[model samples]
Target: MTEEAEEELAEAIQLAQGLEVRGVNLANEGKLNGAMEEFRTALKGLEKFKRRTKLIRARIHYFIGNLHTLQGDLPKGLQEWQKAVRLDASLTDARMNVIKSLSDQGKHAEALRHAQLANSQPSPRVEILVMEGDECKALRNFTCAKLAYARALQANPRSFTAHFQLAVAHRDLMEDVPALHHFERAAEIDPTSSSVVNALAVVRGDTCQWGDPDFSENSPTNLLSVFATRDIHDKASPIHPLLLAYHLDNATLLRVVVDSQAREAARDAAVSVGHAAIQQHTNRPDPHARPRKMFSYKNTFSAFW
Candidate 1:
């Protein structure tokens, strides 16, 4: 209550806050244990002045939760974030993490509940709306998903993700016109996005709009470049190999496939060189996950070859 006591409390809170900042720096530098210790020590100190330190304490817990996630302890991270939101109801980041994690774990109903709650708050985030859409989509509620994606686009007209997702939703419903429109918009917003480029091309193909200017100018170059290394980096595109049979001769296609396989193998080896031990421990083969092999069109191109 006295001036001296007030000054001491301020100094203590300042010190705790500094520790939180330091913890964040350490975490960014990949010193997870050191970051965790800093966060815990900061939180412990802040707990002493509970009434004045609630928000800062909540923030510390949020950082700690992030550290837990980086350390591959997702459930523990979720618990920490839950604590953070409880401590400070307006901590939207923590709430968003909780909702996203729940959604990823296929607890769509719970994630939707949290998302709705967050949406009801003032100035809800575009990401929350997108996540709500994703959850609804996962639950097979196409109407709800469309509405959420539309709302996200309404909030941020230039949002590439929202436009792309909305396009996919419309495309799935066999609505080609609107799908083409959104896909084109998405490609315009992020021209380098391979998914948008491929989808845009497919949608145009569906509508038989071969003369579309955007496709003629950029999409084909980007799409075809996926077969070859662009800037010495393998560009990722999931377009089917069969489609390329219509475009190239057998020898060219085989050469492309061979080069692609070799480049992919080299990249894998380079990436694993420093992380072999870590991969050995953590990369146990998933029973349900298969090693995807390159598709061969040997029969389709055999006569030409």
Candidate 2:
């Protein structure tokens, strides 16, 4: 813009900086209302340089938002944080507030929209991608969910949540090969997680590949009961009989899994016991649809658990 406009912006930055520093001092001295007033005054100047001074602009909004919350104005505080994120998508803290607000309101789609924006920005973050993946999975959009998790893993392969979610997404999509691979990786990284170990056991039983020593600690009662109590549903989703067999009794496993129809011999018995555990913990129950014919677990050994 013109030199006059540029000079105004520079002066505004100086004014906002002075207010921000003084506000922090007031806040520390137990003068919250005074600090909030200072913060509110700072916003007027920062608003003038919102485009060029993204970091400064966002910081002012964040400060104002914090002061508003300190004054017990949660809704107004959230509004200011929302504005901060809109100006600078890289502001993860501000984005988190917006996401949490949306989620608490049961606005899954809206949360996913902002989460996707956060992931698409520079230095794509793992946490936001996981949130996007979770939101997509909740909506039964497995394809997008897996893609989000995949991007997260691409950004950081050691992310246990990414591996777990990716495995679940692939399992939901009936893509057994990739599902099995990710599940194995997740189990390796977190052997202490019952969900991960239980899911691994189900997959091993399905493919008759029970060689891992890590899968040996789980009790048979815990593992078999999960699979034994459930049967093929009248719905369209596929729940491998092997996964249900672990929860059931001997007779139940014998009856529920075995059938006149031949079962999945395709080393792809991508199990979901592990997935179910995660879902239950996260309060996102699996939406099992399109039932597939499943046969009994032929390799149900006693020590396998």
Candidate 3:
């Protein structure tokens, strides 16, 4: 090929690599469909040049394999990974994918061997360590899983997933205290994670830290708090809010206010504070709006009529 054609091929391959990186990111974030679109786009770009497409093509295949794995097509995913390795044998990422797929297929020995080989690579990544832990967990090796998760944690303490997986490992091993501790930390980092919340609740139940058997009905005291911060489940419920409010209060929550005389005061204080927070959230002045309202519509109609 001419020098100009080679340069164009290099540029196209570079564009494909960027697209594949974006696809990998999207896949990591659990956007499989969108990630697949990006992968296909990258593949198309890589297919444009007849020369020097092996590296970029291998990378694209690796990403597509991840998409398949996420979509639960393990056989297809492993096939894609094999294709990736065949195209470019030096791609450690493809090797990692192969190890993960082998582990998922219950081929523990082969997976472990691949992991050992990958560890000998010049540089190691936390993802490889996490996959090692995943392999252990799949083999019902909680101890090994915990160790791997701890290593990942040491690498990056801010990883909510490592904390969560470590908590699960502890839970599986019947290590309640450590399990609860890790679960709580995970919850604090990702408060919106239902899995963490549910796991924390279950652990608390086992440890006698939680007592409520059901939350289908909101308690009298919690009614105020629940209204102040109810979730989608509460919205879907058929129960009448007022009727739901008649349930006995949480004794644990009520204990926050020491004196009986101050109990009601505390409840009122909490309600007022919560209400103000909600009001402030709702009443944030619109950035794109008139500076001020000249007249209030409701009061103006009432006064004029």
Candidate 4:
């Protein structure tokens, strides 16, 4: 090659390198738009240098794909990744990115195909299984979801998300007991998760007691007394203690306080029984020993309104 041609090629290579460096910096800073610009600039700079390094071309396409994916342009992103794969079929990052993007777009069948392709590559990662599980879940293919989740759990038993999602799939299939077990396992893995706690509470029954220490003055009758004062607004139906506390805390009874046919009678009965229950509990000396309070009024009145 002539000295001029060699020097021009070297300068083009340097410009491409500079563009890639700036693009990476932009991407790390969450500047997807700026990063995409830089990547395009790099590609343009390298276009004249057809004999440039294969590694450089692969990296450029991969980065551009990544930026496109981050920008929520999945089609464009996948196209770039496909290009990168063509250049370097062994690029696990590109393959995984394509699969993830496809999955995120709710293209489960396509994603599964891509996932299968990725798994066929050497030393596939556990994340591929997780991705397949997620796609299966989205597609409502519980059997497949369960299989994928099981594989993921086998690969890494400590995967809390996998356990949680498996529980969700089971729950969707009405496998409550198994769902409960997996949910509990997930909670054990991450105790502070409110989602797990709430799910457990709902599936087991909201009234189910969790620990010791009764807060009511009365003896154990049901989970209702654990949180509130139980009393009867009417001779027919008894109100729950927790429901009463909820109404009191909200400064509104279940019965309509105004503008209804049964308003006056309901309010009078609620106040009478609620006041009596409060007095009975207050007269007790051991406040901590008292069961949690409850509303004694039937929820029927609230349900009507």
Clash number for every model? 0, 23, 0, 17
Which parts of model 1 are misplaced by more than 4 Å?
1-5, 211-233, 240-305
Where does candidate 2 stray beyond 4 Å?
1-8, 21-35, 47-54, 66-74, 174-177, 192-198, 201-208, 212-305
Expressed as tens digits, the lDDT of each residue in 30-143 for candidate 2 is 798888788778877676566777887787787777767667777887798888887777888778667766765678899899888887788878878888887887778999
Please give each candidate's TM-score. Answer: 0.71, 0.59, 0.49, 0.56
Considering summed lDDT, which 10 consecutive residues are worst modelled in model 1?
296-305
Pitting candidate 1 against candidate 3, the one with the higher TM-score is: 1
How high is the CA lDDT of each candidate model? 0.66, 0.64, 0.60, 0.60
Q: After the best TM-score superposition of candidate 3, give how far the Cα of residue 183 lies from its true spot, in angstroms.
A: 0.8
- How would you encode candidate 1's per-residue C-alpha lDDT over 261-294 as one tens digit per residue? 3555644422222232223343221122122222
Which pairs of residues clash in candidate 1, taking residues 3 or more apart in a chain or in different chains?
Answer: none
Ranking of all candidate structures by their TM-score, best first: 1, 2, 4, 3
lDDT for position 288 in model 1 = 24
Locate the minimum summed-lDDT window of 10 residues in model 4: 296-305
Tell me the tens digit of each residue's lDDT in model 4 across 105-127. 67779978776676667656667
- Model 3, 1-305: lDDT tens digits are 89998898878877877887788788777788998998888888777673578877886787788677668887988898888877876677787778866765679877766665665465556666666677787778888888888988887787777888888888888898898788767756765554553465456546644333344444322333343243434332111111111222433222221222133344443443233333333322112211111110010100100
